[model samples]
Target chain A: AQSVTQPDARVTVSEGASLQLRCKYSYSGTPYLFWYVQYPRQGLQLLLKYYSGDPVVQGVNGFEAEFIKSNSSFHLRKASVHWSDSAVYFCAVSAYGNEKITFGAGTKLTIKP
Target chain B: GGIITQTPKFLIGQEGQKLTLKCQQNFNHDTMYWYRQDSGKGLRLIYYSITENDLQKGDLSEGYDASREKKSSFSLTVTSAQKNEMAVFLCASSIGRGTSQNTLYFGAGTRLSVL
Candidate 1:
């Protein structure tokens, strides 16, 4: 069975620091990768996605993720973080052309002001 | 912008009682899904619908029933609420399956508590 793993349970970074949240996926074929963020008491919001061609994908809120096929990793990143960037980040993977996504446990990001 | 709405922001029920949660999407998406989120666990799929009147069981569909009344609405019912059960029920929708282009959109979610 295909699965997604996010190793970190929580991460804390200063307001001006950079951020990286790791994600790894297990699948047989090419994977469709996605990053989603959930704010407190809010729904999950799409941050970015990677399908084909581009290994580097940009998302909303100045976030981007690089899909590294070799290591089965898709890590989310931001050049500089802000105070409002605190949220739980989830990494998801889908079988090629399948809509059913397997999500990671998620990493809670806390921005220290 | 389109929106997904889940009714009853918070639900409280007694053990063994039947409870239902409703979801509506204005995006006209062909697919809708229901998921459960525990305090520290990832979202678990419960049930889904490909279109109106079409239902599919997901990984965690046992003990739950789902209904797609129409293209714009879907409802999930707990067959029998269990005591000490507490989780967040989320409703989501997407245009189609296959590619990352069809991103899932979610509602605020309905928090359920059973005592």
Candidate 2:
């Protein structure tokens, strides 16, 4: 079974500061990782996804995630964040043969002015 | 660019009542999915259809039934609404079954509240 773990339930950061939201997964097979973001009263939108190429994948709004197989992690990063970037971010994992995509508990980001 | 629409943006039901949520996609995707989202818990897959009339149960299929009568539509039914239950139901679709086309496009979501 593929499972995603987002250790941070909530993160508070000042605007224009660097950010990193941690994510770890447990999957025996080749993993397909994704980052999805949900704003208030909206559906989740895909931020980025990783399958096999470069370990680091860039996403929308200057967001990126690095897939570390040895650590079983795919951590989302941003050089600087804006107040508009505050939202609930979820990390998900799936495999080639698996029909189910498992999501993490989600990390609610709050940007301070 | 395509859109996924979920009917009845908000639903209020009484305990023990049966509720149905409808979803339609214009992307002509081959797969559709139903997921439930709670406050603290993340999204949980309830059911999915790989093609028209094909239903696959997920880890949280208990007390729920799903139907995919057409390639562009999928519906989910709650067997019984629990009292004071509140959650958001999300509908999503993908192009195909392969890893290359696995990106899911989601609807705005339907919020459900039970009294």
Candidate 3:
């Protein structure tokens, strides 16, 4: 079975501090990973995705994620976060490009000013 | 640039009443999808269409009927609205439906409430 695990249901961080949202997946075949962000009263927006190339993929709003095959994880990170960055993040896994994706429970990030 | 538009931003229907939600995308994408998001439950796929006149069931398609009358429009119908049922129905379109990896463009979503 293929699945995504977002270990932390919620995380809090101070504004201007570094932040990391962990995500792990279990799939037998090669995995295609993606991170999406959803703001309150808004639709989901794609953050980034990882495929065959570089382990670290950069996304919009100065966000990036590193794909670790050995660890079965693709965690999202940002050097500094603002209050506006606080939102719900979802991690998804697929067989390959444009295939059916299984998503994690999602991690809610809270930034304290 | 393309946008996915969902009609009836807010809908309130009676129990056992059949409700319909409409979606239209101008991206010329091949696939369109309908997903339901509960208060705490993650998004659940309800129905998807790969192209014009093609309908595919997702993990949570029971009780829902979808239509792909044209390449740019897809609609979903609630067989029988349940009382006190509340959920947000999201519409998305992508180049393909086979992979989760495909970047999906979503609409603001329709907030549904059954009385």
Candidate 4:
């Protein structure tokens, strides 16, 4: 079965500091990766996605993710964080030609001033 | 841009009662899904529909029932609300299922509380 894992349950960082959220996936075939962010009491919004080609993919709000096939990981990173960036993040994966996606237990991020 | 809407932003239901949640999407997408979100647990798929009148059971569909009578609307019902049950139910849709173009758009979820 395909699964996604996000090791950290919560992360606290200072404003303007760099941020990195880890994600690991388990799948036999080539996988489609995605990162989503959710604000309090709001629906989730897509941050980035990786299907194929270059490992590095840029997303909205200065966020980016790199897919490492060998390590089965797609980690999200931001050079500088803002207080508004504090939210819950989720990593998801789906197999080629499959519409079903598996999501990781989200990581709650807190940006301290 | 299209939007997805879910009715009853917050629901308070009695135990053993049947509760229904409605979702509507103007994206004209062919696939729609229902998921339950719980604290400490990621979203769990309850049901999905590939087209109007098509229903597919997901991993956590035992106590739930779903209807997709129209292309733009999908509804989920809790067969029997459990006491102390508290969770958010999310509705999502995508263009279609294929190699590409499967990005899902979600609606603000409905928070359910069972008393």
Candidate 5:
């Protein structure tokens, strides 16, 4: 079985500061990682996904994540954050032939002004 | 671009009552999914359908029933609403069999409150 772990339950970052949210997964097979964001009262939207090729994948709104197979991690990063970035972010994992995806508990990000 | 719509944005039910939620997608995707989201728990898959009339149980399908009568619509039913079962139910669809590369598009979600 595959599982995702997000170390931080909540994170507060000052606007214009760099940010990083940690995520780790346990999967024996090749892992396809994804980052999803959910705004208040809205459905989750795909931020980025990684399957092959580049280790660093860029997503919408200047978000990016790096897939580190050696560490079994896919951490989301952003050079800067805005107040509008306050939302919950989830890290998910899936395999190439798997039917379902496993999601982390999620990290609630609060951008402080 | 397509959209997934989930009817009854909010539902309030009494304990032991049966509740149903509906989902519709215009993406013409081959797969549709239902997931339950709790406050701290990320998202748990309840049911999914590969095609019309095809139902598959997911990790959290024990207390739920699902029907996919048409390619564009899927519905979920709670056999018995638990008093503490206050959560959000989400509907999503993908272009294929939910492979590694297929992106899942989601609906806004239906919030359920069991009193």
Candidate 6:
């Protein structure tokens, strides 16, 4: 079974500060990785996804994630974050041909003024 | 652009009572999914349907039942509500089952509270 691990349960950052959310995965073969964000009382929205191609994939809101196969990590990063970016982030993994996606225990992000 | 709608934004049920949550999608997607979200734990899939009349069990399908009578609708039922149980039920749909087109579009969610 493929699984995702997000070490940080909560992350606090100041507005306009650079941010990074680390994600690690355990899968036997090639894995499909994704990052999702959920606002309070709202369903999740996809931040980005990595299947194949270049290690780095760009997503909405100036967010990006790099898939490092050797380290089995796909970390999400942003040069500068805004207060609106504060939300719970989840990392997920799925097999190549499977439709079931396993999500990590989400990390809550807070933006300090 | 398409939208997924989940009915009964909030539901309160008594212990041992049966409750059903409804979902409708206008995207005409071929796949629909039901997931349960708890406070600390992330989303856990309860059931999914590839097409109308097709059902598949997910990791957390034991206490739940799902039906996909139409391509645009999927419904979930809790056989018996547990006392003091609270969680958010999410409905989602995708274009197809393949890896590339599996980006799921989700509904706002149905919050369930059992007394």
Q: TM-score for all predictions?
A: 0.95, 0.97, 0.93, 0.96, 0.96, 0.95
Residue lDDT tens for model 5, B1-115: 8999999899999999999999999999988899999988889889988889998788899999999999999999999999977999999988766575678899999999999
Q: State which candidate, 5 or 6, has the greater TM-score.
A: 5
In model 3, which residue pairs have backbone atoms overlapping below 3 Å? Answer: A98-B99, A99-B98, A99-B99, A99-B100, A100-B98, A100-B99
Clashing pairs in 5: none
lDDT tens digits, residue span B23-87, model 4: 99999999899989998887888998888999988778999999999999999999999999999
Residue-wise C-alpha lDDT for candidate 1, range A65-87, written one tens digit per residue: 99999999999999999989999
Using DockQ as the measure, what is the rank order of every candidate, best first?
A: 5, 2, 6, 4, 1, 3
Q: What CAPRI-style quality would you assign to candidate 3?
A: medium
Task: Indicate whether candidate 2 or candidate 6 has the larger lDDT.
Answer: 2
Instruction: Output the worst ten-in-a-row residue range by lDDT, candidate 2 chain B.
Output: B94-103
Taking the tens digit of each residue's C-alpha lDDT, what string does model 2 give over A8-107?
Answer: 9999999999999999999997899999999987779999999988999999999999999999999999999999999999999888866678889899
For candidate 5, give the lDDT of residue A79: 100
- Judged by TM-score relative to the true structure, which candidate is superior, 2 or 4? 2
Better of 1 and 6 by DockQ: 6
C-alpha positional error of residue A61 in candidate 6 after TM-score superposition, expressed in Å: 1.0
Where is model 4 chain A poorest over a 10-residue stretch in terms of lDDT?
A: A94-103
For candidate 2, the per-residue lDDT at B25 reads 100
Residue-wise lDDT of candidate 3 within B1-115, one digit each (tens)? 9999999899999999999999999999988889898755667788888779999787788999999999999999999999999999999988884555578899999999999
Local accuracy of candidate 3 as per-residue lDDT tens digits, A12-112: 99999999999999998899888999998789999999977899999999999999999999999999999999899999887764346667878889999
Calculate the i-RMS of every candidate, to one decimal place: 1.8, 1.7, 2.5, 1.5, 1.6, 1.7
Q: What are the chain A TM-scores of the candidates, in order?
A: 0.97, 0.98, 0.96, 0.98, 0.98, 0.97
The CAPRI category of model 2 is medium
The residue ranges of model 4 lying beyond 4 angstroms of the native Cα positions read: none
Tens-digit per-residue lDDT, A1-113, candidate 4: 78899999899999999999999999999999999999987789889999989999999999999999899999999999999998999999887776777788899999999
The TM-score of predicted model 6 comes to: 0.95
- In the predicted model 6, the residue pairs found to clash are none
lDDT of 5 at A18: 95
Would you list the C-alpha lDDT of every candidate in the order shown?
A: 0.90, 0.92, 0.89, 0.92, 0.92, 0.91
User: What DockQ does predicted model 3 obtain?
Assistant: 0.58
